[model samples]
Target chain A: MELNKDQATMSENNKPQDPDPRFACEGCSVLLDVNDGDRLVFARLSGGAILKIGNKNYSLKPMIGAPFGSLFQVESGDEGSFLSRILPVKQENKSNNVIDDSRDNRELVDNNEAQNLTGEEIEAMRREGAKGDEIIEALIANSKTFEKKFQLSQEKYLLKKQKKYAPKVLLRRPFARSICEAYFKKYPERIGFLRVDALSLLLTMANVTAYSDVLVVDMVGGLVTGAVAERLGGTGYVCNTYKGNSPSSVEMVRMFNFSDKVIKRIVQSSINELSSAKTVSPEENNQQERVCNAEININEPSTSDIVEETSVTAEAMVVDIVAPESKIIKAPKAGAKASKEAIEMWQENGFSSLIMAAQDQDPWSLAKDVLPLLSCSAPFAIYHQYLQPLATCMHNLQQGKMAINLQITEPWLREYQVLPSRTHPHMQMSSFGGYVLSGIRISTT
Target chain B: MLPTESKKAVSFKRYIEDGDLVIVYERHDVMKPVVVSEGDVLQNRFGVYKHSDWIGKPLGTKVFSNKGKFVYLLAPTPELWTLVLSHRTQILYIADISFVVMYLEVVPGCIVLESGTGSGSLSTSFARAVAPTGHVYSFDFHEQRAASAREDFEKTGISNLVTVEVRDIQGQGFPEKLSGLADSVFLDLPQPWLAVPSAAKMLKEDGVLCSFSPCIEQVQRTCEVLRSDFIEIRTFEVLLRTYEVKEVKVDTGNMIGESHDDYNGGLRPCKRKHRSKEDGAVSLDSSSNATSVVMARPCSEARGHTGYLTFARLQCLS
Candidate 1:
């Protein structure tokens, strides 16, 4: 690669370049310039074919091939190009520590400048971005001296321009801000509901479309509403009067109130306007109904208008209405009596009978004793305080309650035991048992 | 309860006393006392002491032997209670209690939750572990057995960290109030799987939970829960054995159980003697053999499972 470049550059020069000496062959004594225009061939004495090179046999057994002048080319026969020999170059040594005359060399250039132009005149030429050869040529043409100060000024100008326009590579993520902004916009309402329990459940339900805001309420709506508003980042309003003894009613009223407004804007307003039909007086209910009916003109309502009606009538009792697609889950208060009442209310409201066997304190001792009953199904939820009730539901389903379906929110049940027989004298052994059961059941279409 | 004196033959009052009761008498001259009763006898070279001499004597009073040797009697305390206790398993030793109590952090007012009411020895300590306001809930599936264990708790009068329940926790989670309420939970079960999640639920955030498993497989499964929900999971095994330490003279010649002469072959003469029928030797072989056989008889190794304790702490997420 080096030889080809040297030859290409030398061909463009007027002087003949030195021939490369590494290509010399050992078999025959010859100096071969492969780049010169000379054709030389050496054939073996017993070769079957005769050798030909540029129409002449330099030698039959060996060859010394060299060409003079810059335009020379080399060619050979099918035996291929061969070099016989070339001598190595020898270098002459000067005084080992000799220093060249630095002042005399400077004097020659100064005298030239003085005879042609002043030093200041030469310095002007150097400042005009002159190359080494250009500077030399300009000095000879104008007979001006080479000035270092002008050269330094021109170099500094070029360096400054290079620094100003140099391309810079910056490492940063350009879409970071936009991605974050888009995320915040998408979940502005949810960002505030990041409590420990809420976040845990949200993570568990990441695959779900969206999480419904769950509300647990009692008579103290102000306290619960205030807490919900602060913790969940939504307005919670107090509605006067108890809904019912049933947990489902409370759940339904909460759902009705939540779906009426966008969660984010609810924080700006008070929740005084939201009310369940159970909470309102009979006269007030009638007045609200009349107002709604008048505004919608429901007497001559269209099909869509009839579907949008809010009132839901069950067994001649007018309860608060629920949006068709909204979901509300209810849990009964802790204790047996409240749980039983809740279950009965749920059963009356079209929930299927999942488990209805009575369990008395001691059934054998008291026949026909009322036992705790559990009922559950889809579209209607029932909650209980104890695991036995839920277990009874599962047991009933296993025994073939086709209409009954139940969703268990709690994942596992734990039982603890302290075994007296094998415990250490000072260390008690408590046997703990846990069972994980699936409670969510989807109805088959 | 103070010591008092009685003029009685400490051993010769057999006729006046009940069966299985032995009496010792304090004699004036190793032979005679002021009174001697039936069903008791004073043991002496001269004759046996009668029950009449010792029957009414205060306990801990000095009683004389045939050769005028004095004997002292002591009343029993609960510390000696276990000596007569009927144990279903190898009872826990005191050596293990010191370590367990300190490590478990059982103290006053601690709501200690324990599962598997093994032998109630640990329960007794736990009762004492928390006193006054502290309470313990111990659960078991065997109702009949747990009732019996409750009787034992009543005897100890340490039922503070002790509540007995007869329910299988595998089918149900922890009681609602107990959920996230317990400060500590100890699990010792053949299969603790059903309790792990419930235990986690019952334990307050940052509460401590520990399980003792004899098997590596049990430890591995327990570690899975500890890693998933608990923080700072740790495992350790405790082994204890006793050594005898005694003072010995510095001089080689003064060493006991050592040989003085080369001909003695580093052996000492055995002081133990064999009893023969011709001599007045009473045979003790039958009783010794009976006890040896009973002691050597192996029961199931106490917690013969892999000995690994897996522990973790409930940690708050935020």
Candidate 2:
């Protein structure tokens, strides 16, 4: 029995270790990324009013859906864009005369033909299709002090009239980027000032690609998670480690019709599950402890064997912890096994990358809990709606033992409309795109 | 160090492999691609790093040199590759590349075409995202750049996913036989308007197209051509703002302060101490009420505007 045990140990020592697998891509389509037909569309008015045409909700899918913000009337069978125009509410028109606004104190024009005209006459002229510009011209001819006001006031008056007459343009495909802009226009508070420029920056900084194993905390609803999943296409895994158990408020993530495979790959585990996963059982720890104690051999054939032995021992402990952990984590049965294996592979290797974005969760705690899980050289990034919490996290991480090259950044997003004759950046844009703290994990020892 | 290159290969390994093009990450902004060969030796200030020693290790592995100095061995993901590649020419970075990929909707099994493969920076990403079943045809007028890009693909192990050809798409207009077969076409060439007509013709029904330009004049001209055959035209500029965040502990007794939102949880215990010496006029209450605050400032080195991505889809007929 003693001879047999010795032989087993010798052969086990001789066994060659395998290289871990890299991320792979398998055609994750874009339709699943945004146009899954479950998209949440908010109109550009009143805290993003839901745009519902009959029983059907429109999304940017199939590229042929009804445009957003176009005033649609339920016609006999079809909705026509050109046939509909929103009119000024009667209440507003009534209030316009009741309130003797100071703007009307200017001297009246002596054009008696216009002063003789009453409200009914103006209403008749409007109903009869008097061009807004022509009506404004007629009114201008009647007023004697039209040019007396300051430039800003005059511009404001023209803008009010323009808004009253202008038609709402139809927004097609209401994709994520457009949705962000729309939401920003309406309830900027709903999305936390997350702009398309900011979203793209997060995705880019995270190194999101097809077939990568990504871990994220998407507080901007599913914006961050969904965008990363879209980039992963279909082959890799993106595990969302959070602090709670219930469904996330990130409604946009559900809008994407991710495949069962993709959904399975997305493990919505609580932060406790991750924190517990980080803990190796004492028995397994003892086994690794024994493995570590054997590392003093000077006659080892090569450095490869020495490294391989310790890596394998560490890998075994990871497998022991990850198996039960994944059950609650609920990783995909197959592709997710790779994810667990990846975690096991990185047991001694370190983390591939880390991405953190949360509003309620403290950035410092989130980074601290997840930092040690990363490999020594893995890249990590933290996203916060405000910079204060992120700064605290950065400060805390700086004093730690595992991270290096820490820095926070805020991207300045500017847009320009390129046209034949008129080309310039939009006059107004949001000043805040949120802040990101990105750095690489390192081990000093 | 282990003989990482000469070891038994993992099953469908996702980690770094021997002979694979890996990026040696020295720092966040500093990296270089090195083909890890068995038995090869790399010299650095830290010490000698043996390529063979990295063989069986996973990607993102941190290894030590002879003097115990360390460096990260990372798989050359397209993004990392873009950062580490020799700057043969002006390159399309992650911001622009991601914008084009997404807006163009270049899925796997979808056929993608591009002109003037500048640094093969964008092609690497395309090849990986649309690998196994999809095809990426890249054309460059510069013969040497094309040849060099071809070699890069071969080295990166994505030659099968991408095809490199020497053709001035603006001058020759993508191969005639390829007309109406492309799912999407991306143009990075100057005078892209000269090729938009042909690109329009090459796209499949409802196929999307994107053009990257640095000037508004070029986009204006291109938009004119695109209007003839495309719809839903849009131009976007992706700006990246990065911030450096840190927490500071200050003496509230003598300091005027601004309060931001409070962080929900603490990563570490805050070392709070009540101010022993308090002035009656200034101290409204005990100084223990406040905690150290965190703040973030934009990194001075945050990259400014890279370029513009113009996207349009082919006009669809019911």
Candidate 3:
């Protein structure tokens, strides 16, 4: 135990040396936004990796050395289709009142014969290696009603045609904001419908910062754990405490592309282990710890395999982009057992903050046990899909005088379309982003 | 209130020593930041508390007053500081602040720039996000407000992480010394469009910029300017609806109507002697039917609107 403590301290003293996060490196996780969020995919960058887009598989090699936020467009060469990085040309400010031509959709008809070009001709143009812009121009010139439409509608038509013939993919660094958003959009149930704004609120209310021992009950996968570690930046511990013998799956942490130092800070411990009295002998404690690890080891292989498979299938189902499963050179594994020294420290001083996002579990039932693990006056936030449980939890905490400043807040996030002469809220917005119960723990004595 | 040293970490067992800052938490809504001094005595509605009594005690512990009333002395955090800080200007709350930090992707070792450091509310959290190695250069037009913000940062022990300056960013733009060095830039100005070109110049390739405005007109103008040199321009409005929880007595009555005599005999009314006969029977029936259950409802009053957050990423074009 003493040696382990020494090693942990020594590692803490060594500053983190992670790769520059601005550029997408090989083996790093990247979020691919297809055609301005028409589709989203999370892929690991490798030489052999392929992302299927609109019936063509594009090699991800071009994106490996490119800076994140670079735009890629599909191009056809003599050999095959490939993705080419395209630099955006500086455009003149055209966001002024250009829609004042006084043309409306009065004479627009939904007939299928608006264009003179056929599908075979467009295919033939593609075979001849014509650029996407050239093809769009040809299609526009052949359209019978293109000249009669309103300017805004014509622009909309051009955008629609561009999307079909010249789709652009944006390369993005996978941070907590993008990851939560991608999951919420594609697989909300997997993350308990915890929106990005809601996740941000949880971290803020909990006061997660560098060197804080943040405790989390992450039934919402590893979203919370990964987010806390990102803020900690390899400087603190984000311990995921669970209810039973086996630890909950935190496979989402892998998506953050965390460095080894940051991964080491992500550990897990059972609730019993955390709250148990430290009266047992060191040898007995060691035996219990070994048993815990064995149990976790038994569950690791199958769960990780499921995670890898789901990453591909998630994209396949959401956007029909059959992502080729590349060889996942395992990053340093997170969620190791909490060391004896660290657990002992937590039991002595308590965690700095607590964030709970347990699914289906009653908030009051969990808070009653977890509140004691937080230091007095330490802020804690609880997330629930329903309001009733969090409300019950807040009421009980107040009645028991276990905490102060108890408030249950639900986050409402609405996105807008900020365009010229047409700025309003998006037609479809998420009505519910879930609720959070936030408060500060107070000492009883 | 970030932990610059391992021993001073939030989870570390550090005692409340002299010359330390602590948040005197009286209630959820009422809090005050106090600097601990050896000869100081804090007098409140509870009573008088001597500074000597709080020394050597761990943070987050309760200290009693002369009348046996107690208040918790908590280690300060940016979240708590936001509540207790003096409002010099309309400040951004947690919802907007958190979203901006996350959306900008500001992490440790990232240089972030903010304009019109209003009351330094969001600046404190930004300092925390870019602590230990990174720095925040916050500019404000009001000289006195900027000085006061610097003092507040010193009080919070984050002056090392943040540099508060007096500069009208909208009028003069950011200082040229910071050109092409920032990882993120945040604008909370009246005419944020006036500063958009300068903000673009300050950000590195692929960096993010966010503009906050309370009115739709301001957002419209800002987005127009941002579209010239930015991509993925998005606008969002985030608000929090807080709920108030209480344990109230509710009656879970059955559908079938029952006779008054049946209720009168169901439960005993101990206070029957103090009430009339009919009143006693009715009170007894109500008591028998009512059960205490915890419930929650949205607080009738809340901040309905703060501001619309407009976020954009610098075009990746070299």
Candidate 4:
């Protein structure tokens, strides 16, 4: 009864309580989706923060206090162009009905004479402060083939022009799904091409949930770490174990906007520290913690430098920019050294699950050492970009009789267009996301 | 499968005790959920196994039967439970379950609502994702199935996180008490379009709703209804292709040699025999020409079509 009381109080303290939980408060991280996923940018909300849309900088001040999922559009005011919140007008489902159009694109050639409006005239229209819709209307009025095209073709033409002229920005909450997708699209190599489906599989296969001690080897830039911490929700711990003296950079954890309670659950420890049989003296353990702190402090500046470089590259590609705030909001840093008590508790009672996403690392080598850290009956999942490594790893584990129910899975994800008369599988799909090796660790004795 | 109550957290101390629920793993494809009682015995193709023999051993360890045949005792997880649970109805599998949970964006402290809790397969995962503070309100039309689901949740130690009720959600809709309180809602009904309004009313602004349908006709009807109150509506079919791995010996030598071509099959059967029994030396070392390599191929039989998952976000209109 006493132990239960202690745990109840501990969990109560870990609950993420905020005054306004779902609103986009100042200094909180937000994901800005531009033009219906044409560009995705992660930015901190601040009064001084600016987003560059179409070579024009707009203050993010109005966006600060708005609820998530609010849509913004660019408008030219007397002072300058600014982002203004626009309520989406409810439209009927016109795409669900089949269109029996007699028109064809055979007569429509890709001739330069289709539009009579010149570039200079369009620029003149923009300078005169015409709305994006008005410009689109003027363009359509001047186009020779606008009325001759099929219904779907005309809609497509209008959408293309709308995107270049007036792009919409959607404010989204930064969850694992969105963060993983943004990274997978912008920098797949940084996250080892671990697709969203594959990442979800890893979490599910490992059985990560509330109040479970999860051990992870997250070499894929902290996407796995952040994802695990997100699920744990400050109730348990997600200990990220490494092999060498320097720990892997989990810089991606900052993007999830995790609370301080959730951030505290994400800690790092070296493989030697976890596997060491000997207990450390109180004095020595304190000194070791100090050294770990020093290492983290030394690694801080470089990681933030990488963050800036990444955002700049995103700017070059899709204008995925981050506004510089006047007052720095230091996000509570994650990935501290595991506490001596926590590490010892894990050593005594093995972790409930394990996940490894070490890119280019041999799965067998890592599994041989890490599989023992999980309690018998604990499930594990290993992700690799290639199948050969996982195949070899599964073979060795079977040979050694260390695990049971071993199976390698490749997640096949296909999206559909889902329109009237056009509902079909997407023309282009990701053929290969990655491979996973999953099983339950078992005791040999 | 999840330790929602603090008292049950001690059950995960890594040891098996009496009254514990364990999965007896016989092979990759065969398993069963067994409750440990002091006097009960499990008889399988292996042999008769006494429950008393498994009381003190750690989970994931092998337990031998009276005839020396053994099986591994595994701790219960939601995934394992999905495979072992009695299928009162056709259920959702891992691929669809994982994708739905992720796409719904379930976190630790978010309220979720699910309908037609079929076999409690996906409901178990839902309970896992929303634990401690959040709750999962699951409704089913069948009274007996609801009772069974309640019993299963109680056995799995996640009853506190999940609440199963008997209600005809498609006919009557969800209870009005839960309106505008859910962060996400899930539906797996025969005519999900009938419950789309209630689902929309239950979700908060920008909350997500997912509907699972096996037929495109049902999906078409559901999508049409969802278009009124939801945006970014998308449909996806996610499946997993499992691979079978094996180590096989392959001959690496060229087949174009004149001596090799002389045989009718273009290659001679190189037999490896022990030259000396005492020394165990091989006469023809196969390692020089043949190598053992681990190779993998897709399993011949797999789940081709489970269902199409239709996901949408509630329009953020105040």
Q: Identify the superior model by DockQ, candidate 1 or candidate 4.
A: 4
Top DockQ: which candidate number? 4
| TM-score of the first chain in candidate 4 relative to the native first chain | 0.89
Candidate 2 segments exceeding 4 Å error: A1-175, A257-264, A277-353, A373-378, A442-445, B1-17, B107-109, B244-296, B301-305
User: Pairs clashing in candidate 4?
Assistant: none
Order of models, best TM-score first: 3, 4, 2, 1
Best by the lDDT measure: 3
Model 3: per-residue Cα lDDT over A1-445, one tens digit each: 2433533444344433555677776677889999998888887777777778877777877776677898999888897778888878888886446666787777778888889999999999999998899999999999988888888778899999888898899999889999999889988998899999999999999988888899999998789999999999998799998776667778888889888889999999888788877897887688677657666564665477466646654555322233455544556678888899999999998999999999989988888988999987688999999999887777667657788767778889999997878888999999988999888887887
Tens digits of per-residue lDDT for model 2, A1-445: 2433532444344322321111001111121111111232322111112233323333211111211221222111133212222221222111122233345535545555434446676666666666555555665555445566544455556655443432222323324554455455545564567666566656655655555557677666666676666656564556666553432444454434355655665654444444444467987566444433432331242344336433532322211122233222111221121244545544544334667777767888778777766655456778777777776676666655456556666656565666545577768756777777776665545
TM-score of chain A of 2: 0.53
CA lDDT of B135 in candidate 1? 81
Which pairs of residues collide in model 3? Answer: none
Q: What does the lDDT read for residue A69 in candidate 2?
A: 21
lDDT of 1 by residue, A325-439 (tens): 2222221111112222322332232111111111121211111111111111111122222334433443333233222112222211111211112122224221211111122
Please compute DockQ, using alpha carbons, for every candidate against the native two-chain complex: 0.01, 0.20, 0.47, 0.48
By lDDT, the better pick of 1 and 3 is 3
Better candidate by DockQ, 2 or 4: 4
Question: Which residues of candidate 4, in runs, are more than 4 Å off?
Answer: A1-19, A94-97, A279-326, B5-7, B10-12, B255-288
